[model samples]
Target: MKMNIKSLYAICTAALLAGCTDLDVNIESQYTQYPINDIAVEAKNADVYFHLRDVFGRRYMEAMSLSSDEYTAVSYGGGWYDSGCYSHPSLHDFRTEDASIDWMPTVISGITKANTVIRDLGGEEAAPADIAPARAMRAFFTFIIMDCWGDVPILDYLPVTNDEVVRAPRAEVARWIESELLEIIPQLTDEVSDNTYGKPTKWMAEALLAKLYINWAVYTASSVEQYEAATAENEKLNDCIRICDDIIASGKFNLGSMPYAEKFGPDNGSQVEDFIYAMPYDTYTATGMQYGRARTWKNAGDVEKSYYGMKLSNSAGGYITMNPEFSRLFCLEGDIRNNSVIGDTVHVYDPNTYQPTSEIALDENGKPIVLTQTVSLEIPDDVQLGVGDNTKGYSQGYRSVKFFVIDDDYKNGRNQSNDLPIFRYADILLTKAEAIVRGGTATNGETAMSLFNQIREYAQAPLLATTPSLQDLLDERGREFFDENWRRNDMIRFGTFENEYGFHKKDFPTARFEKTCRIFPLHRDVLNTYPHWTQNPGY
Candidate 1:
């Protein structure tokens, strides 16, 4: 079924409030709008256009988080691992066709909408503003494909028929994105408008180009000449000294003045300082899906005396948690990100009203545990948690705080106003530092760690040695961008895609995956449906 604005909005609102319409909204279409002169017809098209834009952001975040870091693992106590979905048969192995399904349709659907908008706005009589959004949407979708699948079926020319579709190599896709951004940069407004703050400005295009170059080795193995070619394509990266430098000089974005926890912690409704581009969320609009809450176990009660929350008379459960290996990487002290993103404290919830009670402890195993003896919604203490031994089923696992649900308002398994950071300033600085390292420049004598220190300073963490090596940069990226969805690519870039990490990497099931696994398989559904389509090699 075609996704219309009303329908997409309805789903977001429904998910936020379980199922209710207490909050109502009428969003104007970013494309396909009725002209004031032709209000009725324009309104119809606008409605469809706006829904298309919504899907673009929604799908973009979900795909990136799942495919990249922005997540904790569940290996020990039935937790999710960064590579669990990447290598397991029943989980998410990108080596085969099945792993690409969930995100493929959403992207293709969004592309369809973008194509429609571009077509309608380009017709004989249409406002230029109507097409501005279309151009932006196109760039956004193409960027996703470029980053994720690498060599993708570029639909820039729009559909002639399914038979006409052909796959473009990774290098070509990258070029397309670079070209699209350059073409549209002039059309986009540089102003930091409210809803559009996280939207792509010309600077975002520049930053993205830097990111593309920084990871160029991972996408395609061209020699030094190819590397230089990528750098040449982005005059902006040079103009800004680095894309991050450009973003800072732009003076539009900043690190949050608040502490790290406030910036990425439970009480996340407040404006985040580092957001360059993000997906807007709003509780009142009833349109936010708190992935953070979804990843977190419902730990509101326990055994003592009804602990801290009202016991729902009944319950159904699902399993997801943090991996022990991934969690251990956080320093016990000094790194502020540990406290902000990973809270070791256990908050007991009152059974009468689900609020936290102060009591944190660790089990004999050294894992943190919460005491919820009194309430129905209880997250088990570590000693009692399920570790998939058939005795226990995986409880007491660490919950995700990346997008925390702080209050009953936009809180508790749902928060709308918490915008998803699509791009951040720190990302820029690190990308530039990496590019400089690879480009053979040590003029500053400041190595990758020096650049990493700049990002660390923003996170309020201490700096490493000023002239650390390339491996240090890779490790820092892992820690800093963990679960943020850059792992598969980073692994490839570091030449670790086939290698393992810690214990999990030892007995990985589908171990044939190599650097080639960096790119996802073309969707089987698409391949099967289109007769002339060809699959990627090694798939």
Candidate 2:
């Protein structure tokens, strides 16, 4: 596997990363041979992980947070009015290239790297154990692409021509991913150590399968226009339970292992035991993780030093705000998640020791800074967003503290060491409980109520007294995973993505049930590059 290149296929990699090859691409050039297989399986796999980091950044967050009911952002009178693209998700009135669409190429970049590793290793048959992780990661990237943009292309090898780049139907893509994951699961590592830290393991792969099964109906449905979330049923609900049971029985994860807030701080990494899979963003080495820009204020380094033990280098105050309806979920007495969402007024903490001080945070003219949970996303025409540096939100909505920062983060400026949790052990218990509630009898002796209460009881919140229903499970998911990028998926599954929450309504009523809005249409560039492809219905 020595290095050599100078082929159109090499150039096609760049094209594919930008999207599929253009129509004018010279198909015959793909015939030129190159000995570019110098990339090791591990190096190609590392590239896959790094490419995924770019995806979880800006555009993806706007789509996931801004679209869903969990959080929203507006002009705030000064900024965030990105020509109305920022509010398109909430309003359901979108133009091409909205935040939700660009991740296709970014995700494709990761998938292409994973595919290259598979191809260079002489295909999956030659080194099943040595290269199985790449196959697993490839499936993970495909899952994101499919979840976001319904019917999409599936590339197993480098295409020699544009004709090889046709889009696969959504159902076909899901089935192919399922078969690929099933074949590679045994080859995946079973350990949960540093060797497999950010990479997918047997448990994480199973978790992915369980997720696919639970959403089988939605993915395979002819159309979501008439879909009902309350009475939704999945034929693979039984399969989902079985997969979740295997992970739960392994005894590797525990909710009681750490305090609720500690699960997302700088100390939360692979060894934490609560996370099944996470994106390991670090302070000194890893980069591209800036949660402060989404939640913290601009002058936090000078104002609220009592926060995470370092002076934050940057912040985008009011760039995002919590929705009132979703904010009510944190009202349970003694729930740790409530402490993270700052509302009303509280004392300012000391910076040096990160301790509580007698001094309270006040706005410009000596007034207490208070956070509000207003029902409307609109601000009165005469009101202002930021008056002075000291204000927390005298006229603002609720703020968040998820994906918290710490002292080590000071070294990397705005970037943080907080490992982003994708799947957690609590999700396993909840998924199995949800599957059972949806008419799949648990093969194990565990009842739906027993498994469902594990998450709530451990979080120190009240436990459910009766059997959980679909709506109850939906509400519980909203509470458990607010800002972790799970809201859009849950909202779609529950048939609520089309409804207006906080910011969608400005002057008049805007909430209605629309099917096409369930999944975003293919990007404009994608549609134009491949003329044969049709836009999603009703787009």
RMSD of each: 8.7, 6.0
What TM-score does structure 2 among the candidates reach? 0.86
- For model 1 the local lDDT of residue 457 reads 81
lDDT of 1 at 317: 25
lDDT of 2: 0.67
lDDT by residue (294-384, candidate 1, tens digit) is: 4544432222222222332211121334444455556635776664233345554432222345644333244455421111112332211
* Model 2: residues with Cα > 4 Å off, grouped in runs: 1-39, 298-310, 349-359, 363-366, 375-395, 407-413, 505-513
Candidate with maximal TM-score: 2
Clashing pairs counted in every model: 47, 0
- TM-scores, one per candidate: 0.71, 0.86
Q: Which ten residues in a row have the lowest lDDT in candidate 2?
A: 1-10
**What would the C-alpha RMSD of candidate 2 be, to one decimal place?**
6.0
- lDDT (10s digit) by residue, model 2, range 1-539: 00111122233334332222222234354333223332334444565655666467556777777778887564454455565556666556555676555567667767766665565556635568767787888888888888877887887665554454777888898898899889989988889766566777898899899889888888887665645776666889898988998888888777756767767776677667788988877554566677656666434554444344444555544567777878888887777667667666744543333333466665434556567677333444312122222343324567776666554575566677677888888888888888898888877779888887888888788888999887778788887877788788888887777666775554434432466777776778776666788887768
